[model samples]
Target: MRWLLLIWLILWGTGVEVRAQAMSRPKNLILMIADGCGPASITMARDYARAVLGRKELALDAIQVGAVRTGSVSSRVTDSAASATAYACGVKTYNGAIAVDTAGRPLATLLEAAKARGMATGLVVTSRITHATPAAFVAHVPRRAMESEIAVQMLDQRVDVLLGGGWAYFLPAAEGGRRADHRNLLREAEKAGYQVVRTAADFRNGVRRPVLGLFGPDHLPYEIDRNPQAVPSLAEMTRTAIALLKEDPEGFFLMVEGSRIDHAGHANDAAAHVLEVLAYDEAVAVALDFARRDGQTLVVSVADHEAGGLSLGRNVDGRGIYDWRPEVLARVQASHERLIPALRQSDRPDSLLRAWLGLDSLRAEEQALVRQATVKPDRWPVVLTELIGRRAVVGWTTNGHTAVDVNLYAFGPGAERLVGSFENDELGRLLAELMGFDLSSLTTTLRQQQPVGESR
Candidate 1:
């Protein structure tokens, strides 16, 4: 009987059932990245949703597959550029590298490979379209800060859908833009057959195959400070991108990034961070919904790295009395980005700071810190962030990235393969394999090509 069972197991492994499933590979891939989000970030956002939004849980929290260790070749603590490069190119490179190996050699990104296979590719981000995370997937540059070159490369790649900020980099410096060269990329994109949309209404109304939407001069505004008339929400962009990319018969690969979560974390603003996570989860919901209905789509949600080392706990006084002031989080009406600029422009910085932060409920020492922040121009952002964090019972270790594992949530076809923890670059390999591409062969091909900087 044991011998018969062994024979049955072997047959099942190579049977028609396994072969049929393997032949029906996923037709669409959606990678959702919440920049600077870690497990602690998710926990805080989950609790905040439970208390404030009155929702049972976020869409992302419901699909917890596992975690991934995020580290670059250069350091244990990874920056957004390096971590993004790992997933985009399936190689561990230096912290500042963008889609390039440690020696500044270019690597073929998943997007490039997908496009090469006749798949539609789309990038939807809350950051500038040429920002590090989005740029890594399409542009090969030695430094992530080369926005001008990145923008040129992105258009040259002919990405099917492009949405987000950083219109400044595409415009010429003569027109109040940042680019030193006088190349009008907006016009270039139009010549390349892309329908450029600058307003939310245009984004929602425009129906085009290759679309370009640039809503802000720099990065888009935080959710709390966003003007809906000017900037579209992350969820809106995800929906629009899906609608456009799903038309391709060859399938599609779309990357949606909640980029400002990293910015809020860098500021150590718990209120903004929680809101950004919630906003990102909304985009995740959109992808999950599509994947559920399509069945041939795989939706993977992950974070590049953890920033701020955020912790949520009860506040302690000098007398060692523990107090839980969850209601203090309710008083935050604006984000640090919104409040800081207002404070800087205000005639009475102290009054504006107190009102913006709701510091009436804060302790005397915290209130004193707020006053100091108002007076000291150089240290104002840090001190103000600390005051708000203290009031909300949020603690932060540093205003930088941390060497911590981040959560990975997935749904639909091919998600089970990502259920275990692994190195950051390994995730890229798994993704490429799922898409029926060998990342090793792609990297080998890139390495054999003329060195990136040399003329052919």
Candidate 2:
């Protein structure tokens, strides 16, 4: 009986490779990263979307599998650098390093491996391309602080498509930055067989080869504040990157990160966070639309962690808190741009009138009371920060990072392999297997046991 079971497991239907073999490796890999996303963050976004759409959103509804664990390599607690490293290099390293081992040894990123396998590679993010999360995939450093140096690493890797910000890191230090490089990355990339494009028009005009685009000096503008006439929305960025990468016949790996979602949450600005989340969801919709039509592509969406400890401050059902009308949320967000800016610059009620908001602008005396509004935040259901989220019916737990299990959503071929709980590092391994690269080929060893998410 034991031999029969072993035979079934090892040689089932000879034509079909069971276990890791049955599913054909992904020809195209689209990894959607929500920088500071956790289950709570996703749940909050989902509920917010449901209220406005009056139904399950197609972006999240395509989720066929969800995971429960998201720990970094060194400890139960993790930061973006460590977390991103987990996914960038299958083997886990210290908390602040990227694509390196615990002994401070640098390892090859999935992008480098994919490129070696004759696959095209691309990176897209709302954050700077040199940011820790994006850097993990192509840059090896002992510390994430080497962001500028890491920019050179990305350049050195010769990734087919590089989009996002961090131009400051690539420019000479005299230009108001710490970077030591004087070489123009865009020009260098072009010289090294990459076409450099910086505007929407660049994407509009089709290109015949790999392209490198830098849209901003640091991280790209937050989705809420980005001028549509200038920077492309997250969805547009995703769609354009896809079109470019898909042209490669050897298949491609594209990493699109919705970075500012976490940035907004980190600021404890609820309204901003909601907008960022929406922007990311729109990008997800773009990816799914492509995958659904392509049939051969595999799309995986997950977060590195959760930010601002976001959770409902007031239980809507328990406290009679009702969902904010979508229009109301939109108005609030627009209003705050003018309102909050003044609020941040003010100290008391005496200057309350300073707010450009049409609301009863507080007089000097009123400003005094308004300034006090931030007090006793723990006792109240709202605050200036909460006001941001409340307009969208979004709430938060605190204004800092927390240990939590982020979400994992997947679709298309090979997605079934992600149906169960796994660690953050395993995600890297899974991608390795899905891409037809033997995990060992990268020359990294990862624990076989799955890492569990904080939520579980």
Counting clashing residue pairs in each candidate, in order, gives 0, 15
For candidate 2, which ten residues in a row score worst on lDDT?
Answer: 447-456
Name the TM-score of candidate 2: 0.83
lDDT of 2 by residue, 1-456 (tens): 999998987676674655446455678989889887766666666666776556576486568486746666676667788888888777766778777778666666677777887888989898888988898888777788887678777888788888887777776677655566566655567778887766767666665457677777778877667788778788987888888788889988889999988887777755566668878989999999999999889899988888887765445434646544443344443333334555555555233423322233444543444545645323122345533443345566765567787778888888888887778888888887777776464554322221211110
lDDT of 1 by residue, 214-242 (tens): 99889999987788887889998999899
Best by lDDT: 1
lDDT of each: 0.86, 0.71
Segments in model 2 whose C-alpha atoms lie over 4 Å from true places:
1-12, 18-23, 53-55, 175-178, 313-328, 334-369, 372-383, 389-394, 444-456
The superposed Cα distance between candidate 2 and the true structure at residue 109, in angstroms, equals 2.2
TM-scores, one per candidate: 0.93, 0.83
Candidate 2: lDDT of 171? 69
Instruction: Give stretches of model 1 more than 4 Å off.
Output: 1-12, 17-24, 314-326, 359-363, 447-450, 454-456
